[model samples]
Target: MTKFRFYFPDNKDFVDPNFDGRSNNRTKYHRQYDDDHYPHQILAELPYDGMLVSLAGVGTMQKRGKYYDQELTEDFYFSGARKFLRLDSSEYERIRLMGDCGAFDYHNEYEPPFTVDELIEFYDRGGFDYGISLDHIVFPYFKDEEAKDVAAEKCDLHELIAESERRIDITLKNAKEFYVKSQNYQFEAYGVAHGYDKNSFIRSVKELQEIGYRRITIGGMIKSKTDELLELLECLNRIRESDTQFHLLGICRFENIPAYINAGVTSADSTSPLMQGLKAGKYYSVNPNSIRFSESLMIRVRQYDHDNVQKHIDKYRDELRQYISELQDNNGFDIDLSSAALSVNECVKRLEIDCLKKLQQYDETGLDLDVTLKALIAYERVTNENYLPSKSTESKQTQLKRNEDKYHQFLLAREWRQCTCGICKGGLMNIIFRSNQSNRRRGIHNLAIVTKHKNNVLKSINPAAK
Candidate 1:
């Protein structure tokens, strides 16, 4: 039986809530951060044993020179015993450039791309358990002739192919060079296999094997659909050797994991759960049987509508006044009527009213209005600020017909409340009610749930392992 591992990609923006330069310095943020923060030290604290961080990400961070610009020297990125696979910077840059040229939208900028030697130095200094040879691969979107033609005017296909071949040669040469340079390093270097078609993929794998790579990573499949990926997996399966282990780069779909594993994939990586959690409507929960469930939160009345803003404010104000009067009548607390008309249309008013209601519900005394207001303001600023709900013009019947399945799933998950994950432990309402940290926490919880499911499956298959 084969041992399968899931690798989490290090995307600082998604995981770290306090990633800004003020709270935490950008230079050492990746390598070090406060462990007490829920999502900041996720990589270190999470059960995941493997990580897949890009050289381009580190290079970009290095180029910015946030904290350790002058101190980077030549090997700052890889100075610790972190178990990660160092991906080549070229493919990352190509994706950035392609996005710049209108291939697709990519978030990060491509800056100060690292050379092969720099990568090697980074690897040597950073005590990684495993490293992958750098290979430049083409994006799957370029397979379409029309798309290729459009991209060719700006990014030439011929040039990309040549560059890819050159990178492969460099990767192979560097793998051997590094092996000879640091024979006692104890780090395993795997070759990267990249190609567009079946024959090309076979040739790439065969060449990597010939160059003394017992382990290979299959690239150029990130954008591929499930069917397309399966076809590629089938092609690889046909030529796979018994002793060689293949890692599927960026293949993180839970439903497709079993298929990939059955097709001979030993390991894979993805940030889907984390990404999903950041998006609107999507929420993740774990089922009783350990299967992960995804359901969209029901869209409620839009709070941002120009017409309803005043209406909501008026209603909340009425509710607040009524509650306060009830409290006064029952001699529950002292009434401060001076702050009653404190700009009802303002967000601060809503936050204060909400917090006060919560306090009243809990029957708490010594209400520090200032502290509660400040805390609520901070949370609202991150979670609810600038949030605009989309106004759909479709009929209610039509909308229900379209979202029948989604509604069914939402109802099922809402009723059961069996999901015991950290995020869902607070109850489905915490995640269903959209808030910045809650959404991200839900994603992290989903990742944990899916990881457990994967481990369980692997354990069942390989029951002999302790």
Candidate 2:
């Protein structure tokens, strides 16, 4: 069986996690939670085969040379808990090597591809079961962001694969070659996506099958348009019909882990604790059996709203309550509500509108294309920079006005249309009045073009306690 693995960069002392790559404000920036940890020792502690030891990409200034950080030395590996027990020299001889798909120079925008031979030498000398890492295999070209140029310059398999395949093939070939030569070894490759679509991912998986590659890992905190992570997993299930082991990246929340795995992901990874330590000057201190929120009061704040926005909040809360109710009623705890609730297409619609409202509130000019695009291209890359048909070097001020106008026009066109929020069906659109019911802001929920009659019926049936 292909074992599920975790990367552990050693933080033996749990020393101060600060580094110079960030501002000094102590803000938990994304990188703080996303990168940097010595993982060798930690990975050894996991009971599952899914864990792989990787050098934490923090504190290392130079990108080249045989040694990455202090973590790569054989001494460190030998001293690791697994070194004496699970990882013997003979076991190492019979081991397979696996690498994260995104760990190479080309993926990081450095010059000169790290050839497969160099990688094999490193893994062989390092004495690992598998050499695995991520590579930019499939580049999705949305509007203007063409993968052809990037592929031509960085990917050697450009002619052999599509935008998505280019990224997967590099890792696949590298792993396969290692397995063939070692005779005593086996290898697997993973594909990582910070931002790519369900369709593109499906296509990439198909191409992987065509080339006989079987393992895939998906995700990053990159803006994903799909509202539910479960939806993404379901898409993976569709791809895995032909037998592929799916891995979820950076999954720290315990409640969410089973959902992904149940949806067919063979294993998962979590850097949240390390990320938290780097971010807030402390670790997240995760409990694998519990669910947590980023802030304790977010759900409370949503629950207490005095305006129509509370309707949306209430819907989410009710959904949560319903899941719990189902768990109790069925006496079974393995329900996948994410896949059971809605389709990916429905999720994209709700996310696009919600993100658009957020962009309007956050964007200074009320038309920040980058921010909007970031949200817009959450799951998929809108690579076509020139795809903006209207604005050709338009001023920011003009762009804001144009975008606002477009937004209002969309409202007018979709008027009387009942738009159900993707997160919850109970939140259909209603006519929002400019009443200062609470400290509420005018949001997409406020302007939702939903089935007001159905909302009225729900309001009548489930009125808030006065």
- Output the number of the TM-score-best candidate: 1
Q: Estimate, for each residue in 205-238, the C-alpha lDDT of model 1 and write its tens digit.
A: 8877776677787876788787877877787887
Cα error, candidate 2, residue 452 (Å): 45
TM-score of each: 0.62, 0.41
Off by over 4 Å in 1: 13-32, 35-47, 60-112, 141-184, 287-392, 395-419, 426-433, 463-466
Off by over 4 Å in 2: 1-51, 54-98, 101-106, 110-112, 137-195, 219-229, 250-253, 281-290, 293-466
Mark the 10 consecutive residues where model 1 has the least summed lDDT.
95-104
Each model's lDDT: 0.50, 0.37
Summed backbone clashes in each candidate are 1, 52
